[model samples]
Target: MRASLVPGVALLGSYPAKSLPRDLVAGLVLTALLVPQGMAYAELAGLPAITGLYTSILCLLGYAFFGPSRILVLGPDSSLGPMIAATVLPLVAADGDPRRAVALGSALALMTGAMALLAGIGKLGFIADLISKPTMIGYMNGLALTILVGQLPKLFGFSVDASGLFAELIGFAAEVAGGATVPAALAIGLGGLVVILALQRVLPKIPAVLVVVVLSIGAAAVLGLGDRGVDLVGPLPQGFPPLTIPYITLSDVPLLLAGALGITVVSLADTISTATAFAARTGQRVDGNKEMIGIGAANVAAGLFQGFPVSTSGSRTAVAEQAGARTQVTGLVGAGAISLILLLAPGLLRNLPQPTLAAVVIAASLSLADIPGTVRLYRLRRTEFSLSIAAFVGVVWLGVLPGIAVAVALSIGNVFRRAWWPYQTVLGRVPGIPGYHDVRSYPHAERLPGCPIYRFDAPVFFANARTFREQILALAESQPRPAWIIVAAEPITDVDTTAADMLRDLDLDLELNKKGVDIVFAEMKDPVRRKIDQYELTATIDPAHFYPTLDAAITAFRTTAGAEWGPAPAEEAS
Candidate 1:
């Protein structure tokens, strides 16, 4: 089926009745995770904690209506939050106006959603693979480190004013040592961190944050942490979010565009990976483009309802599955549950501390660094290791955009670097083995008895086309004048126009009716054969010369050029 029609095809009816209890449990667990996670991610984005709540409620409801996954949870994510803040901060003035922030963020969400929708419709999901595993790991590790350091000040009950990540770290350190000296603040921050870390091991699902928050607010109310200069969550509106348009302008488009670009790329990658995992786990078929449309709708709706961009949350999805959620109704239930909290119990959340929220975010951010994978990369492939480190350094110093750009550049460079000098083999037979092997590695191997067979193991393009001809000619010259030559085309995927032209020229100059220097090709794929036919390379050499099987070519060579031919010289063989 075409991608545009997938949404309609993925009908939402016929859910199991057993899913009701599962949906309720999944809703409650997801709410627990979303509540603190929303607040922390909001802080990460340089937005108010209440914005997280707004984002969570709106995005969940939106996804429930449009998302394809029964259990996928969409909301503000820790990985993307810092990137959004970094993108928007440079455009806004000091202590940016809330109206301007809302407008810019909403615009970004819409832009991102539109881009994703178009891409899905076009079936361009494979574009996500352009970001290689190494580069992604490096970029994510750097992002994780940045988030951890950036949240330090908030954890210590102080704030830093620096814009760039490195400068922020320095400013935070300087302020922590000199400017801010609240013992109670330090205690709160440290206590929160310890509590969050320890509780993660024991009561993983109890929302350690809510416990720390209730205690912190209660202590502030009783022991007066507020009097000792501890930062507190100020008055938040006690009502459900009201729908409104953000103040959009022609000038704000470009700034928001950057955020949208980043968010769209990350969201597509995340959604695809998450959806595929769940589909595999549950033995269900997930339409990639369908998931894209679902997420796009959710983002569009979120922006309209004063929410930030969202992607499938891994933690919440896991909770839904564990709670036995079997249909999209679980997401609808979650949205309803969160709505009830917003309407009836908004005041119960007033006592949450910034430090506690920061701890939760820091914990999430820490998971972004795939240290084990990085170490494995270092041991396995140094080139990929270099790319990972480069991306990490670039993201840290140059910000997310420049870092992503560098990572892509590095990836392409690596491809060209390897392709320029692809793997070449000097064929020789192993002592006990019948076929020829690479002589350089296999010392005891013998060359082809008499004929020379040279294989160029990459697509013949402008970059390595000339190298292909030169290497084969040199191989022919290195050994005793060969009776015939066979160019194995198994590894050669394609030949460009330039390469084809080069082959035509080589045929005229090298073969030229010379009985002792005939050239034949075997195992060539149909596409290359078509190009060869189109270019008339097959005409001069006779139709019988192009053998589809390597054995047929070998048999013809033996009949026409005699079977007494032994392997050609090692260095000079073609």
Candidate 2:
């Protein structure tokens, strides 16, 4: 039925010939964005601008061959720049040898690719949810601030040797105060920034970035700005690098591996989100695992050719879509165009100003921020907002790598915390409403004369076994205590060994047994009930106390304990 079992094979087999011309035109438009952005993002990552082009070319071709989504574009992205720099730059020597840096960048890309490939093969695409939306928003906000700050010195035509965000900020201020600013550099950079912002706001459909870059280059050439001390891109290296596996010191593997895992996670998240957004418009389905495999292949291709790791660029993908791209042919065409430029016209952008590249990166950084998302989180939920703020502080106060670690740890901790002390409420019959409802939501709801129905929102596990026991004990000890306590257990999807043991101990506890307050379970899942029996908790918990529904439990309690419907005592009403 199929000519090839290879990934993305069907893309070509099912290709519509009518789309060829459109793909070609879209590819040319995409190339205009890719050349400048690829170079800028590479410089942002502390690599040579030429390596960015190599990365763009190889990744585009690789994804065309392996990526699942036809319209999703892969390339060097602004958000990944600081992360790549954090991982690869420290490994470089103090002199910052460009060759060593490229080698290390390539090695990092390979490690990232291998890890992502294995993850995809293992179907671990669910790890993308490891960072909650609030935390992710905070991380991006911090990254945006970090990038914007890091590029200021380049925009002003100087360099800050200081490390850390605070140190860089201080160093930048000192440089500006010490008259280290280059007038020509500032003029071009700010002028380009203003032009880009103006055009983007006034005519969003237009390619303002391409326009500003072209005008900047023309101005530099006409005014002889390079002679006036404004730095220029000069000339890019000609042609693509030969395909060869990257190498690094054996001692560096552990560090690089750690960074690679983080990089893979972030890249996977970015890819999935971008793919989903585009697939919605194109009426396609998303496959996260396949996306991972695709990105892994792209990174491998880039690594073999002296390039760093990359991620999805939403802006560039948007450009291709607007230019009427229909399939991977657009990506192939763009790759071929870049290859031809590298071979035939490497110096076409020689007059492009360095500050203009900074402007491009800074513009990308601005787009990376999700300030409105952060504010909305704060307004909607304060607890989640705290997690967001913590993530932000982690990125700003700590470094990028550590920030990622901190955000992950916080995400996991928040999950654990909610489970350890999940929401507990008393349920009762709300007049004419439904089966049951939280009494707190309706204070006048009817309740059993001597028993209370309680609901716990999480599974019973060791982490919250003690909290569950204590809350039950408190209810049993209250004055005018009920003869029976009913647990609405539908939400308790699991009961681990420790929690089962805790339940048995509560049954045997002197306080509950002495007071003649019996505990009963209602609407528990069958699997959890089996687990309780397996743990032998039914021995002390009483097998007869289990009921199929809350209604059954109430009927049994009323029959056995002779309880009647009435409002709870004043203090326990809600």
Model 2: residue 403 alpha-carbon error in angstroms? 0.9
Candidate 1 lDDT at 500 equals 83
Per-model TM-score on C-alpha atoms: 0.91, 0.97
Q: Can you write out model 1's per-residue Cα lDDT over 1-574, one digit (the tens) per residue?
A: 6423533234444555666787787777677777778877877887777778788877776666666676777889987787778666666667787666766666677787788778777887775555688988998898898898888888888888786788988898899779685677778777877887788779776666666766777877787777777777766666776676777767777767867877787787788788888888868777777677778887887788777788887867876787777666666666677677777787766656667777778878877889999999999998899999999998898987677677667777878867788887766556667655666667555554446666778999889888887876765665456656777788899888898888777777644335456678889999888888888877666667788876677778778656643443545443
Task: Please state the error at residue 149 of candidate 2 in Å.
Answer: 0.8
Stretches of candidate 1 off by over 4 Å are: 1-11, 179-181, 202-211, 416-418, 431-436, 481-483, 510-518, 540-542, 563-574
Q: Which stretches of candidate 2 lie above 4 Å from their native place?
A: 1-5, 572-574
Q: State the weakest 10-residue window (summed lDDT) of model 2.
A: 1-10
As a whole number from 0 to 100, the lDDT of residue 42 in candidate 2 is 97
In model 2, state the lDDT of residue 84. Answer: 89
lDDT of 2 by residue, 27-124 (tens): 99999999999999999999999999999999998888888888889999998889889988999889999998899899988988888788888989
lDDT of 2 at 336: 97
Worst 10 residues of 1 by lDDT: 3-12
